[model samples]
Target: MKKINQLYTGFALAMMLLMSSCVKDLDQQPYVQETSASVYAKAENYKRVMAKVYASLAVGGQEKGDGNADLSGRAANAYLRIYFNLQELPTDEAVYTWGGGDALNPLQFITWNTTDEWSAAMYYRILYTVGLCNEFLRNATDEKISKFTPAEVAEIQAQRNDVRFIRAVAWSHALDLFGIPPFVTETDPVGAFFPRQIKRPDLFSYVESELKEVAAALPSRTQAEAGRASKGAAFALLAKLYLNAEVYTGTGKYSECVAAANEVIAQGYTLEDTYSKLFNADNDKRTNEIIFAIQQDGMNTTSWGGTTYLVCGPIVGSMNATERGVQSGWSSIRTTPQFVSLFTDVTGTTDRRARFHTDGQSLDINDVTLQTDGYGLTKFTNKTDAGGNGSNYAEGLVDTDFPMLRLADVYLMYAEAVLRGGTGGTATEALGYVNQIRTRAYAGSNAGNISQGDLNLNFILAERGRELFWECTRRTDLIRFGRFTGNTYLWQWKGGVKAGTTVNPRYNVFPIPAADRAANPNLEQNKDY
Candidate 1:
């Protein structure tokens, strides 16, 4: 089920969408058009609208290439693009060299304020998707289901459960990034209105509860479509939430983390034999490993963000753009030295996972603006495993699916939980899981294998970098390990200094966009913002 073929790119969806309002930050009050009641009167329109919700994750709007977007700004404002910026840019995993004093540029230096556009875009993108989900969920009630045949109703029920999982993912991101974000549900009215802010602890419970229900009710891992949420996705998300339960709820839930990880493992999701193929243009075929992904089609769902950014963002002056499956390179993003040092051999002679391009580039980044400063990362590309370009490679768009949750991440999370004294899994099991990942990274060899004694928290952090750097888990992993802020761990230009300096602790959580607070007085700013 390549759901990318089903993405709703119709003008009707754009006309019927009721963009969710969280205040001035979102600018969503103006998008209300046709009544959702009339739109859903057609039996097929339900799927059309649901496809729009999923498209919100991949493309910016109904049309292609940032024209008539669901949210404002360029294609860079898409959900996954801003999500990558907020998650990876502020950490040591990546560095964007096009910083002409823009909001997205300050992230590498950790100098962003409350008025940053990228953060506001992320806030609006999540809520806008939530708003669409709320509308779909509100209409998928018992009375509404009576109108459809039994088969349609059964499908609707499953899709509605999937919508809940999508919403829970948004709220979990809020719990992780923003201390308190405005909250709403299907019970709320369908149009413009102020929403009350949810406390971090309360949001955690809501996300947890929703995921639990979805984990049990949704289709099994094998039963789900390619891009749709499955039981394994819910369990994987639950495992992630539980892994960070200590940061979100002020209580260590390592035992719960291990339990959720166990459930994910029991779902029969396996690891891909080759690690590089997991992110290539043909990644959709690796559904056995990828639990859930935001699907992208170069021709159908054309956007400048999503995997398009992943493929082109790191392509530089001397690198082969055609080999990267794009016509040209953006020459914008590169890897940090600390990240390059994670692998003993930056040239990737031994570990196939170390896909770095250091031809004309230096491992050290003395000048952040120079493309030759940092090592160019070739981890993501629009090229297929069979040596062909993606569907939309001609337009510089990409067909790579962004794996939101995968078995490798869960394997690491389970190992981390076990090391933190979780009871459900043992050190021996954790060590085996870690070695499974290591052996794959080392290409079926035991060269990177580690002992049970080596399966500590610090090694887990470094191994996570080696396995999952550009996948957008670095900042969160650092936060869980108490190294995101302060003098603990410093990489290139951590605090706008070449030698790396400590940042204030308040930088941990992004400040609630100031415009949102002004529009809704009920919302309070995060501390010291």
Candidate 2:
């Protein structure tokens, strides 16, 4: 099921969407469109509407390339693109060099305030998706189900469960990135008073329960469709929620994290032989390893955000644009010197994962604002495994799918959980798993294998960096390890200082956007914003 093909076609019908009120933090008006009523009359139309729910993540709006957007500024309003910037730019994993004075550039230097447009865009994107899910759930109530045939009702029940999984994912991100989000649901009446904010612990419980219930209802890994939620995706998300349970809920749930990861590991998802192929144009077919992804296509689902940013953001200054499979480089996003050093082998001869373009670029970033200061990453491209420009890709656009969850991260999560004394895994078992990951990184070199004595928390952190940098896991991983903020960790230009300085712990979680707080007084800002 390539959900995008069926999903994106329903955009014209998406005109029936209810406008959310500014004061209500996503206020809903009763969906009263006659077209929507007629469309929902058929069972198959339900599936197409469900595609719109998933489409919100891949494309900004109903139409391609920015017209008729669900949110304002469809060009920069994409979920994955905004998500990547928020997650990776503030950390050592990546930095941008274009227009250092751009309002969004403050994120790279950790100087952003609550008024930042970029931060506001990220908050709105998450809530907008949540609102879409809420509408779908509202339509699937018992009242509506009573109108359908028994068979259609059953199908509705299953899709409704999948929608819950989707909702859980969005809410989990809210809980993870922001301390808490303004909460709403199908039960909330349209045009009701402003929705109150839910604290982190309560949000955690809600997300956890929803995932468990939906995981049971979803299709098994092998039977699941291409872009649909499966038991594997649910389990993977549960594992992530549990892994960061201490941070979100103030209680360590490493044991539960291990349990959830073990479920995904047992699902028979094997990784591809080459690491780079996982990010190339043909990645949609690599469903064996990718648990869930924001599917992007050069021709079918065109967008300047999402994987298009990934393909074009890093190529700058003498890096071949044609070789990168893009029309030209944006010359903006690149990795920090600290991140490049994680590979250890400057030549990239040891680890195939070190896909850096060192040509005419320096290893040290003396000036974070200069394009030539840091190494350009070539990890993501619109090329295929055979090194040909992907036949499916177009100039200035790409077919690379943005992988949101994959099997390799699950392996590392299991190891980290066990090291933290989580149940269900032994130190020896964790060592073997880490070694298995390294063997591939080193192309089966015996020297790359670690001994039992070498396995520890610090080693796991470095290994995760080596395997998962630029994948949007760096900031959360750093936070979980007590290195994201404060004096515990520092990188180039941290806290807007050249030598790097400690920032207030409040920087750990982004403040609820000022515009949202002003519009909805029921919402309280994160402390010290």
Model 1, 387-422: lDDT tens digits are: 899987668889898998999999999999999989
Native-referenced Cα lDDT, model 1: 0.84
Give me candidate 2's TM-score against the actual structure: 0.94
Cα lDDT tens digits for candidate 2, 354-410: 888888998778877778888889989998777777544455768788888998999
Q: What lDDT does candidate 1 reach at residue 218?
A: 85
How many clashes does each candidate structure show, in the order listed?
A: 0, 0
**Residue 270, candidate 1: how far off, in angstroms?**
1.4
